[model samples]
Target: MKKQIALLLSLLLAPLVSAAPAPEREKAQPSAHHVAIGLPDWARGSTIYEINVRQFSATGKFSAVTADLPRLKALGVDVLWLMPIHPIGEVNRKGPLGSYYAAQDYLGVNPEFGTEQDLRDLVNAAHAQGQRVILDWVPNHVSPDNPLTKTHPEFFWRDEQGNLTPPHGTDWTDVVQFDFRVPALLDYQADVLLHWVKNFGIDGFRCDVAWGLPTPFWNEVVRRVRAVKPDALFLAEAELPQQQVAAFNLSYGFDLHHAMNQIAQCKRSASALDEAYAKIHAHFPRGAALMVFTSSHDENSWAGTEFERMGAGYAPFAVLTFLLDGVPMIYNGQEAGLDRRLEFFQRDPIVWPAETHPTTRLYQVMTKLRREHPALHTGSPMRRLDTTDNATFYALERTAADGRRVVGLFNLTAKDAKADLFDPALAGEWRDAFTGETVKLDALVPLDLKAWRYRVLVK
Candidate 1:
């Protein structure tokens, strides 16, 4: 696995290393408000949790997840992004269960999952606990067996012989691509997006492969969906220059995630994270929120779990995302430290760790601090602090609008590190977030940290 990862990253970075240092990300200019998505009051500092109902529990059903709402609420999650709930097409399926993205019908519920009423019950239950639910949407493609293939053939592409083909350049044979040029097609999709809010009262959508489709289509969908559900939020699967203005409230921070991984694997210095964050903040539109994470469905299934890729750094990175800017996401079983490569197209249930486990406790503590600390909110003012070992140690200080302050530090290498940090602006007494002890930062303080360890001090 180590060799495979080394080869993969080498290929991905070969071109990047040869290229000149990228120009700093460009600041977005003003654009029309048609594609703008409004932020809700509850989401300003809230965290998101991703759930694949099929693998969430032993039953692999909606009831299993609904039953666990209180526990999730305790974990400090504000929104639940459920994987696609539509029925999977039987034709040309990849595995016995099939890929979740190959939707057979937009409006139909997968019996393998549960009934529409079951989903409605789940949503109602989540709302009762003060949490919102968003469905994962697949707008770029559909299973060949989908009704759109027959009802509106013009909605999809065709070859010289008039045969529908898979999305360009991939081995995804189970699904066919949709052409975004059709006005009627996009109009129909806008309705499909509203169906959840109009009937089941779903809070929003997490658009899959959002960058693969056209920007105008998203603009239209956003305009139509928010017409009635003004508080609904949108999370795009990919980040693009125009995606922030194209209608998403948040998008994946792929650049930052990759850089962090490289740092953990010893391919890059700890300061690489600072470079990645700076570039994304500069490029994304004003007020745009980036989603930072250590693991996800794709990362777990394809690359490896955080355990394999980050190893000892998993705990530190997990804590870092919670204390830093941008929103944090907890993929199912992440709190329990899932260690296997979950099968994407098959029946693979996650074996959660015992309740008293350290990972679970760490998530519980970090998430509570994430919810309670105003200093940790997205868009809060932050500055990088100088550290003794610039190559392996990272340190930062953040200040919230309410005057709350927090200082965070991490040792990103495989060796013990002593990073010295102090700032007159932060001179004062402080309380450790993980421990109840109080310490003074009035003078230059030396942090003796273990490899892949992180410390957070809140005031």
Candidate 2:
């Protein structure tokens, strides 16, 4: 009777176990629309260098930047992204100098930075050196004292008392938000963009707070601008996937940047990078370009310098920015190891060192490698190679259509770690980018990396 009871219980459980459904796999969420924009030929393999004009030199003038063109060319810079060049509003200003994003005029140059012709000459000089120039454009808002506030009151958003307001959910009191619902405002902004491209000969624009505007506005503006300059580049400060659909050629890699910071602080492991990349691949279109960087204007001023946040992991993370399948950027004072938080709304200029900094060589080598190897360019295919220590060691291989290949090995921890990379595809003779030594890999390659060490090999 006991044996009979046990058989009956097992029979009842077998059907329930078989009837249970399998767990569903996670799926990637792609953008609503397909990306229609193509990157300009000039930007495919290029690197961007941002210049905070207000803090770049003691004079903080366009002439100073113009004078540095030759040096920039020698440093392997292909694009110069100048921070806002318009006059800052005096009313409700943040500091003595005011915020650079608070524009007073769309078509006028800041007297503090010199005359309009000074900017024209700077653009001309950069173009002569085979470098492209992009302006940081503030379209979402303008200074409270801007002429538009009085002249075209319809272009602004107002509260119940009919008073202009700042951008929603922020403490940016110096500037008033724009009302994109007004058709004329769109037309005026479109014209403003065209004016720079036509008059100043600017290669493109870096749209500030781009996510605040509607996508259709950017689509229409890009359509109108491309009608004038077919290869004009547009970079969006936002990370929205839709921004790259038909407007921006590049968007910020905010997720990846944050992941790097987290990993550096030991709050997360190197595997966090893989998760970040997976999300990026899932959300963005196949060929969308992202700008990878360790530091930027906002990051340097508000949060902290790279050294403060990333500490000893700074150099290795910088190497990852260049090796990854995206266009890399170098902030103005990064090469000189600027470690202090620059005053955002003041006249704190960067002090120059008489001798060349070691970081300059690191950036030069990285940029040179990008120029020589199409495999390192944006839109190239990247494959992750499995390693013995996946949590701390990260390795990847990128290959271009022209059969060129490059590999990067990074140890994202602060302790000694060894990883035996296992990838049959890695079997080849490669040249070391830094030491100029030859490395031959078979089916397996053992890497003994010190804390925060990295290696770049080209084939």
Give one digit per residue, the lDDT tens place, for model 2 in 302-362: 9899999999999998888888888899999898888899999988999878899888888
lDDT of 1 by residue, 1-459 (tens): 999999999887443223222123333443433343435667767889999888998888998899999989988888899999999998899989999999999998999889998999999999998899999999989999998888888787665455777876668999987877678888899999888889999999999988777766787888899898988889988777576775788888888899889988999998998898777666666667778899989999999999899888888889888776788998988887788988988889988765646787788887788777888877788778887777888888888887898888889998887867766766788888888789777667778898888778888
Q: What is the lDDT of residue 164 in candidate 2?
A: 78
lDDT of each: 0.83, 0.88
Off by over 4 Å in 1: 1-38
Q: Which regions in candidate 2 have their CA more than 4 angstroms from the true location? A: 1-29
Clashing pairs in 1: none
lDDT of 2: 0.88
Q: Estimate each model's TM-score.
A: 0.91, 0.93
* Error in Å for residue 183 of model 2: 0.7
